[model samples]
Target chain A: MIISIVGAGALGKTYGGLLAQQHEVHYLMRSEYAQVKREGGFTLVFPPPQNSMQIEAPLLHQDAKTLPPSDLVIISTKTTANHELGALLGHCIKENTLVLVIQNGIGNEEWISQLVPHNPLICGVSSMKATRLENNTVEIAYIAELRLAPFQAATEKQCEIIEQAFAATSPAIPVKAYQSYKEIRWRKLIWNVPFSALSIIYQQDTQVLATRQPYVSIVRALMNEVADIAKADGVTISQEHMAKMLEATQKSGPYYPSMYFDSIQGKPIEKEYIIDNVLALARQYHIETPMLNLIQTNLN
Target chain B: MIISIVGAGALGKTYGGLLAQQHEVHYLMRSEYAQVKREGGFTLVFPPPQNSMQIEAPLLHQDAKTLPPSDLVIISTKTTANHELGALLGHCIKENTLVLVIQNGIGNEEWISQLVPHNPLICGVSSMKATRLENNTVEIAYIAELRLAPFQAATEKQCEIIEQAFAATSPAIPVKAYQSYKEIRWRKLIWNVPFSALSIIYQQDTQVLATRQPYVSIVRALMNEVADIAKADGVTISQEHMAKMLEATQKSGPYYPSMYFDSIQGKPIEKEYIIDNVLALARQYHIETPMLNLIQTNLN
Candidate 1:
């Protein structure tokens, strides 16, 4: 399958580099046009070669304007950058391009659906700890199960092809196809909301964060609240899974979450996106949410 | 009045040296039997003498084994060393000795009472931050209220005499006699449980701890839980007072709490005493105290 992975920086280059090894992977670059149009295409440092995957100028284009429409368009960009990625996807997408959004934060699926209304939108939450080391490299420090939540009712053959494309590029990374995607998305949302948002609010390392009694308690309370909202929204999320989410965060402590990175960079925070989403949902359900509410209010 | 002050620390010496100018003040040292004994008398450094108090030794002895029993024994030992002080208090008291506990932490009433079981015990809490300089000099940091919880409903004249003793020594400090001592102790207990314990737990400076969302939340939750326990125990702890308790700790940022001092020294942490008291009370009331229980289980 001809795969044009859009917005190729860190996560973009991550998916692009890995998939490119076994398939035709086209990397859509941003404004640094001349730098990429020459040589040294998406420099990826994959495992074995994984420490750094330096793709020596694999068929690179500067923008969607330069690229041909493809079968699968994996939009791997920042949640804030999703709209631009979506607009580009709309311009270059074939009639039935499976746009799998492998990004953090909430509402990327709906964000793309609104822009490219005809494109099949699937929101997949990736738990890979990938840190970008300049444009030339990204380190995939850790890998967890990657889930592609069901968006529209697509064919089994289409699903297989999409899965195969991702699998071929990164065979080690599992892409589970969820029949009920909201359940998985919200479950993933439960983990992201507290860990990412709280990490930003405290401006502390994740390892030190786990040791703080208050932060841990708040995280647990927020997860419980998220579970309540999920149950109210008719999504089945178990307590054991909630505990697992916290445990996963504990294991991922040495690695900084994206929200914390965003905070340090003085960029616009995701307080409104991650926490506000759950709070808005809680309000819709008329749930009492002082814990999550206060955490929301304190986010910068 | 023939006044003998034990524990010749800052506050002890401050009051002792002041009263020596007018009334009888004896600086009861633990051991002067081995040398360094002088009848030069306790020198109270003053605004009169280059701004330093040099109190000559009045009376020096080690424990109950030495010295004659006096009318009153003013105990000013550190609360962490309260057990040892309590043992000394038991060994040295005369028939009519009145012991005033000038220390922090909850259960001072019963704690000291357990050691010196039949003596007239005055459970008092002080907000005076005292720092002892060289020799006998001391600096008073803040002038806050001092509450003396009634030992056994002393007569008006007895109360007046105790008041007069304090007035003669420290004119700047105000001592309030509380009809109910448990209420006052619980109020102070609320402050230490969250801020001090958290300071030790997080090893964070006051400014970061004061406003950090999780720290503040843990603090508020601990206060709220303690307040609920107080309510269940029929203590009139208001939300207004609760806010004030938090405000005081938050305002005093960058200050190393005494508990933090104890933690660094590898001494027995005081959360077992301060917070443990509240959690026990909560257990009695069947109160749902997630925060206190969480903190208690952590450091222990």
Candidate 2:
């Protein structure tokens, strides 16, 4: 099966390179298409001892008039750049093209659903953290399970075809399907809402937040607020989930999150999808989220 | 008249040097006593072309046997060092000593009042911003009016003696006495609570806060919260006073508050007196001070 990844960033390159081991994968990057084609393919370096392999996937440029419709088209870009998605994917998406959006934060799927109204939309929340080492190399920080849920009325066969494309990287890149996209998004928010905002505000990473007393307490309060907002939105988040999120953060060690890295590099932050959405829901539910609002104030 | 200025940091040195122009003044500092005494005298530099003069006030060490009773004893130190005031001032404060505590933040007077119960206690909040240039010298950033109020039952004659001691330097260092110490402290808090907290949080100074929009809005909210807490404590802060405070902040230009500077230099912050007192009063009156509490969380 043919798979096309829209973004060419760390996440896009990591997953695209892994799937390229078995299937025909194509990377869609407008600026770097020529250089990538000239270099033959990019390199994917896993953990030590694992030989770095060349990813020979073909390159797709932005200027192409028409795109070959693939079995699955994965949208893996920063939410800030989502504005260009419609123009980029216009010719690439077919009627039955399984649109799998593996992006961070909330509300991106609803955006795509509006654009490709008839396509079977599969929304996946990935916990697999990755980083681009160079222009032609991508590194995987940790291998965690990816949670996939259908946006609207996606059929089982479409989910199967999407999961099959990732089967080669299974176990290490396992996928778990959920019935409701909203629940999965909220669950992912349990980690994103607190860690992302705090790591930026305090200038500390996951380990610092986990070990420090008041920071740890603040993390609990933010998570609880997110849970309350989610429950008000008809989604119930369990206490066990909260504990698991905190535990995972403690185990991640001292690691600066993507938001912290972006701030240090003076890049545009993805606060709208992460914090703005939670704050909007909080206002709608008449919920008091002082900690979250404080974070929002710092970001603003 | 003799005046012994305790805690010879910036605030201590500035007021001490000014008073030395008229009265026989002495500065009390534990670590810098030998150096200050060896230097013979330190210079006090006012803003611009004003000729900086040498201050020949004697320096007092921590191990000084018995302190010569001063007509006015001005305690100008960070609130954190108030704990050591008992040991330091034991031999210094006389029964009739005018204990004018020109300290920042709250709760210090309460502690000092408990320590030196018999001495007439005067609480003065100085808006004069100054910085220490060397071990003995200090630079007055702005020569503003200093508000002096009796803590308990300090007589008007006592206030007069304190003001008369500062009369020689009155043009550069004006003093205004108030009837209620509580009211003046709360008024000073209208400026301190927000600016100090925000400067530390956003790592920006007063000018940044005044010019910025949302930050300006947050400052108003915090000031309003403080005013509400003050009112609940039986002190009526006028709307005009609030307007004046905001206007003064806007005109003061860019300046880092003591708290921000302290945090940057890795010194102990006076948050307990500034924020904790406000939060305690807020909780006592069943008032909601979410923004202030949010600032408290970050400090913790």
Query: Each candidate: what lDDT?
Result: 0.67, 0.79
Each model's DockQ score: 0.02, 0.08
Best by TM-score: 2
Candidate 2 versus the native: TM-score? 0.57
What would the per-residue lDDT of candidate 2 be over residues B90-164, giving only the tens digit for each residue? 767877888999877777688898888888999899888788776567777768788888876587778777777
Residue-wise lDDT of candidate 2 within A1-300, one digit each (tens)? Answer: 677788877788788878877777777876567767788777777765566667774555545244667778889878877887888787778778888998778888878888889888998888877877656777776667778888865876676666666776622467788888888899888888888888887787888887675578668878888998999988899999889778877887888888888888898888988999889989989986656767787776
> How accurate locally is residue A73 in candidate 1, as Cα lDDT from 0 to 100?
83
Tens digits of per-residue lDDT, candidate 1, B1-300, equal: 556676766667666666666666555565332332544543444333235555565555555555356666677766656667645664457766677777666665667767666667777777666665444346666656777776643333455566776665544456677777777777877776777776776687655666666567667788888888878877778889888766766678567767787789787666645777677778889887655655664556
Where does model 1 exceed 4 Å of error? A31-39, A48-52, A153-156, A170-172, B1-220, B224-300
Q: Give candidate 2 regions above 4 Å deviation.
A: A1-121, A124-293, A296-300, B64-66, B170-172
For A1-300, candidate 1 gives per-residue lDDT tens digits of 678877776777777777777777787777544676665665655556345556777767766876778777888766666546645765568788777778765566666777767777776777777777655556676556677765764544555666676666543566777776677678777877777866776565666556566567777878878888888887978888877766766776565678888788887666655777677878899876646755664563
> Can you list the residue pairs that collide in candidate 2?
none
